[model samples]
Target: MRAADIDKLVSVGRPTIAPDGAFAVFAASRPDLTANRAVGQLWRVDLPDGTPRRLTRGVSDTAPRLAPDGAAVAFLRADAKGKAQVFVVAAGGGEPVQATDARAGVGSFAWSPDGARLAYTARTPEQGRYGTVEGLEPIAEAPRRITGIRWHANGLGYLADRPAHVFLIDVPSVDAEPFYEPAPAVRPEGEDAPKKQLVAAEAVQLTSGAGSYGGVAFTADGSEILAAVDEIETDRRDLSSRVVALSADGGTEREVLARTALLSVDEIVVASDGTVALQASGVGEGRVDFIAPAVGLYLLEADGPRLLTDPDVLDLGEVGSHITAVGDDFLVQSRSRGTVSLVRVSRDGATASVFDGDVEVAGHAAAGERIVVAYATPDSFGELALVDRGALTDFGAPLRAQGLVLPGEREITGRDGYPIHGWVAVPAGEGPFPVILQIHGGPYASYGIHLFDETQVLVDAGYAVVYCNPRGSAGYGRAHGRSIRQAMGTVDFHDVIDFLEGVVAGDERLDGARVGVMGGSYGGYLTAWTIAHDHRFAGAIVERGFLDPVSFQGTSDIGSFFGDEYVGVDPVQMAAQSPMAVVDRVRTPTLVLHSELDYRCPLEQATRYYAALKRQGTEAEMLVFPGEDHELTRAGQPRHRVQRFDAVLQWWARHLPVTG
Candidate 1:
């Protein structure tokens, strides 16, 4: 795929199965070149050999939830103010009616058991803040008091002043007419009577106080809503969450269900019998640990909490993974050997694969005996496929027609004889071509079977792309992931070098002498470190790097505990692993790319690295994008993503030019 192919790329997500297993609804999104934004809408497909068809027409619609009674489908759609709110439409067909008018918009929502009401979470901003009162601008708002560690987030800035709270709103009846209230009688004498004002049903706030709530769900009887609450205390350091039970009627205070003190909960699911299932990871010594002991499944029963899945064996996807309770057991998405599959874990920790193969399962939903999954492979983007049968809808067919290069999978032997899984994507030419060693962010993140656009773009530019999941990467077992903890640039660095060398030695179409290394975040750290230790690359691109852990801890969002867990606290020990300490040894031409608004790694990392390289008389350049966070390549603006691709190609052309 070329750089412009990004506009034609399509993916499907957020699949929800009907209660009777008759149909499934999902959301499909594609970039709009004209508007320079992503456009999404709802799509539906009937079960048992039925064609998929468009269900709703919205600019941006996502997070579809099928009602319990199967009479309606509720989803989030952006309003005129660009805030996502809940909208409901009939299961068969009809216009979608807006059910909420929240000022701060909704984060997530779930249908009640009886399908009469919906439970959702939204930020409850202070009355005088966030434009809550008319004529009060954000710039004119009062200054915030310094209190919490998590006061500022990456995309949502200054969150301490407006903590999220649970809310309940009744669904509007499709057959009923629009409700309106008369205007006040005290109008100006010169003007005629004002038109009646349309009034939406008010939503009741369920929880309050200095905390944020998410992942809401109702019990079997729909009496209480279970939500995960994060209370940021100044004394506490670990970012953990507590499960709470709130009355659905807003009649009483929320009751603490489970503390989950030492564990960090990413998602939660409630069973029919009031059992709470959590996908959590252990934070040893109350500090965030890296990559080791992957997130596992835990059950909060009446007696106590019990481990349901083995963390060493199965790594829960956590980001796009879904957990559904089935009787006494649960079905969740787990990553193993670079592939994500749906697994069934019994109450006693007996794990069985429900859907396992070469595909990367992004999301899944099931009801009764019927199951559907949204998956992606090396050639296809995410598609809606049935359990036993193959793909039911081809959402990526248009992009596939534009020609996508499929990566060839390989297994390399590391310096220590450990096996490293990797892939190589070569251009369509016959002669040898320059190679690009691409590294993924999150030293824990892996390069999987998904069709990545970055690799494809390089291949289309007549350059070979190589990527591997060395030690410290996820999707391998816990031992493999934790092998490099506190020893970042030692064995993991050797493993990366070994994998790249092994691929070059075996492949005939790659020119090893002309290679360019590039990566972002943790990958950027490794790229900078790799060029410094071994001057084999002609050029390098370091984007959003964590060059110094000491400075990162003070500025980054997760920096407070991330460096302490991975790099340790000793200044001398941290210096040995940091790239900033050894950047003077670099001789390769480098391009330092960064985002101005990125809070994950912060912009100082790029500036510091670039300045050090330039001061030492080494060739260097820096590129900064405005109004973008750390997720620039993945979810940035469409025009900006294309512009980034153009810039990368220009850098490669100047340093390691690919020739036929």
Candidate 2:
């Protein structure tokens, strides 16, 4: 498959299974090439056989959560401007009803235990947040004031003055009989979305506080709502979260428990027996990388909160919200090494892997005696399947015929005898094919389990793809992951080279002389570091990556704290770790790609690296994408994502051609 062919793949998330295991629902997203946009919609899958069907085709309908009784499903649909609002529809089939209409729209929601209400989050609309034209248009056109230290985020851009608060939406107990099931929500030619008559929903402001809140849930008896609320009167970026309980009637507000700065509740949910379940974590003394915070299941009862599961491989997957409670034991999603496992955690602190596979699970929902999950293997983007007992069913059948290149696993030891995990994929009949070492973005993220789009595209281009979880990468344990702090390029770089050299030497199908290294974010950091430190790479590609930690402290969002924690508190120490510090030694041909709108790395990082390379007479090319963010690959414009991969393919084909 080619890079553009990535559009053909569909990914599923936010899964929900029916009570009786008859059917399941999930949100499926795919690139709409005709519309030049990525669209999401609700989809249903019949259990046992895993027959899939699409439902509710809104512009961006996502986060499908089924009601407790399985009578209805509620989801959030984004408008043309991408402001989200809640919507609900009957499980049987009917016109989806708009359920909530807050001024700032809705964030995330939880269904009340009795199904009488939904406790959701909504931002209080402020003057500057919206305008007559549309969301933040007036502010973007004329902006002079800069009050907040952290102003812009990558995907969301400028932060609104309003803070998000908890809100409650009444779930109608009656069923809706629509006069007509309308066609898919579509925008007319040269216009916004087609006008529609939607049902008005009653909403009430649940928590009026100056703090940000998320990971909400409703109690079993429907008396209170639980959420991770940070009411600290400080910068929203630095606030530590705590679980808070708010009355369903929006009357009482109480902190459920208090945690030290060392640890806090990442997610909170109430089981059927009124026991509170949460994933408590403390990555370090104070680390900012929330992607793979060292976490374990914790339960709160009359005695107070304590760890229910050991913090070994209990690092929760990316989805922090969906903490499924199956009876007293909670079905937890944990990642060990590079593999994501659906683990069942008991109150007695015992944990067992529900399913065994060399694959990653995106989400799982329990129904009757069965479990439905959205999983992705090394060759499939996503598959919705009925995991009967502990076996994977026919979810990958539809996508399997599309021809995917699956990788084989390999392991290598890094410093201190740390075993670094990696995967290698080679095309058919490979004779020392050109290699592209794929480095995942998050220094804490893994790349081996998922059907990595870039790996597939590169392998199809006749290049052997190599990816690994270096020292800094997660899925191992706490000590191993935190080992990257203050030692960014040194330790992780050794792990990368060790794995690459071992893998290349062991296999005759890998061309070590014609190998290229490419990565983004932290991976990008390592790629640039590798090029400067070692001169063997044929080419390098670094996107939305760090180059200098000195100026990055002032320019980038979360820069000050991140540099302080990750690199060092001193300016000289921070600069010593950046790739710009050793730019004078870089001889490898490098491609520096950064997004103009990427506030995370900031475009100046690209400018610094590119200018240094050019001044030093190094072969380098720079590409800056307009209106894109640090998430230029996965969440950026579909066309741009394709173009970015095309650039990599062309660069590799020119520099390290696979000769016939």
Candidate 3:
């Protein structure tokens, strides 16, 4: 498959099955190149029989929550003004009506236990005109002051003075109507028509003050809302969060649980008996790098927050791990060694793997033993699958019909005796095909088991694709990852190069001399490192890479934590880990791609390395994508993604051309 084919795949996520299990709804997204947009909408599939259907539409609509009564579904969507507001519609279908008029837009939300209210979090407006003038006239060129460690974020730039606070919106009763005359677009079901607009429910601001709060959930009686609190402080280099319960009516609050400087709390779910289930990180410490802090599952009871699962035996699975319907048990989407699986862990710390193999489960909805999930594998895009009593049923028949070519995977021994997992895709009718070693971003994140579009495109262009999880990658215990802490270029570089050496030695079909390397973000940093220390690669592509940890610590949006987690703010260690420090040693022809608005890595990180390579007289070129950030390759415009890949193919063809 080619990069342009990414628009054709229907991506599924946020699957929710009703309490009674009559039907299920999930958010599905599709890219439209002709329209220059990607739209997300909800789809309802009849349970057991499984007939998929769409429910709402817009630039993007996600986060499907089934109300307690199962009579309606509340979701977050952008209104006509392009602001996210609460909206609801009958599960059967009809025009959806806006519920909240939150001007600043909602970040996330949850349905109360009784479903009569929606608890949400939205950013409050900046203190009026910098506390002086009334509007834009006062702040156009006004000096913006900063006193917080988290001054900037990746997608959102400066934090300003605004804070995101918990909000409550009441749901109207079944018998209600708008108090005004309707517009001409309204469909008059005459007295027979179901209710169009429920009596307008007032939006109420709950918790307010210094901290920015989110991850909203409900107490058992539905009289209070619980949230994860990020209390704003002078120095927040130490990441942490506390759980707090706020009065549903918006007046009172009580601190429920507080963690230490090492751990952070997320995804807090409360049980019927007031038992709290939360996923936390930093249970086991002593590492300096960001990848070693393992997330452990915990349960909160009368005593306090108690660790429920051991990180040594089982790491809290993927980012979607949550408290399960069975109060005592919760489903952990975990990554082990290299593969992702679903494991069920109880409050007492007993853990059991429900399913483990060559599959990546994104999200799951459970009703006793009937657990259905949104998952994918090597060849399939995102699809719905059911795991009933340990037997698997694949609902991705249509995706299989699309004929996506999947690569074969294998495990290799690193030069240091660690197991490195990798995948290879060879072109049809190939003999000694030119090879390209692909690296994934997030030196801390691992590659998925599914068919990645970029790798597939390279394979289709008559190149052998070999990609793997080097040291410092996730899913392989904390020790293996933290191994590259003060030693980034030394250990991780040798791991990939040595793994490539194994691949070329084992496969006679690969042309060892004509090989290229490419990656973005952390992947990009490794590419820069590979070219610096190794001369075997003929070409290299580095996109938004970290050149020097010292510079990164000062410029990056996440700069505050890099000093503590990456290199400890030492100058000698920073220079040792920098690719630019040894730029003159690079002999391979390289291509650099970067996004203009990427605050996470920052644009200067790219320009500095590009200038150094050119100054050294190495054959190099740089391409910049305007109006895009670090996620350019993943979530940027469909056309832009295709264009970026096309450029890479062209550059590789010129540098590592096929020769008999």
For the record, the alpha-carbon RMSD of candidate 3 to the native fold, in angstroms, is 4.7
The clash count of every prediction, one per candidate, is 0, 0, 3
- From the highest lDDT down, the ranking of the candidates is 1, 2, 3
Error of 3 at 69 (Å): 1.8
Tens digit per residue, CA lDDT, model 1, 1-660 = 888888767788969988888999999887777788899889999996699888998998898998988889999998778889998988886888888878899998998888999999999898899878899888888888967666677877777888999999988776667656565787777878766432257789888898899988887788988888887768546655677888887636555544545667777787877777888777665545545655888887766567788887788844688788766778888887778888988888998898888888888888886889988887777789888877898877877888888889889998888998888999887758999998877877788888888998988888999899888898888788888888999888888888899999999888888888999999999999999999989899999898989899888888767787788889998999999999999999999999999999989988988999999999999999999989889888888899999999999999988862
Clashing pairs in 2: none
> Against the true structure, whose TM-score is highest?
1
Ten residues in sequence with the least summed lDDT for candidate 3: 389-398
Q: Give the per-residue lDDT of model 2 (tens digit) for 1-660.
A: 777776667787858888777788888887765666788778876767655676786877888988888889999987545678888888866668777766667888988877778888887755554653466575375554655556555665555455678888778533654434457766678866544544446677777655677878887788888888754333434434577788887548887776454456667878778888877776444434443465777787766767777666577745433467887788888887677778888889888788648767878888545877777776667767666543233444544566777788899776568787889999989487988887876777767577777888887889998889887777788677778788788888888888898898889998888888999988888888889899888889988887788888778876746766678877677767889888899999999999998888999999889999999899999988888988788778888888888888888888888782
**Ranking under TM-score, best-scoring first?**
1, 3, 2
List where candidate 3 sits over 4 angstroms from the true fold: 127-141, 172-199, 283-289, 389-403
Worst 10 residues of 2 by lDDT: 231-240
TM-score per candidate, chains pooled: 0.96, 0.91, 0.92
lDDT of 3 by residue, 1-660 (tens): 766777766667757777777777888776668766677788887777666777776568877777876778888787766778878877876667677877677888888887878888988867554323445575474576877766777876666566789888887543345455444555666655443443387778887786889888888888888898875457555566678889987548898876553457768877667677887776324422245666777777777768877776676646666655554578877777556777887767788887678777777776656676777677665777666533133444554565555777778887768778877788777479999999887777777777578877887788998888888888787787787877787777887887788888899899888899998888998899888888888899999887767678778987777644655557776777778778889988989899888998889998998998899899999999888888887788787788898899889889987663
Q: How big is the positional error of residue 635 in model 2, measured in Å on the Cα after superposition?
A: 1.5
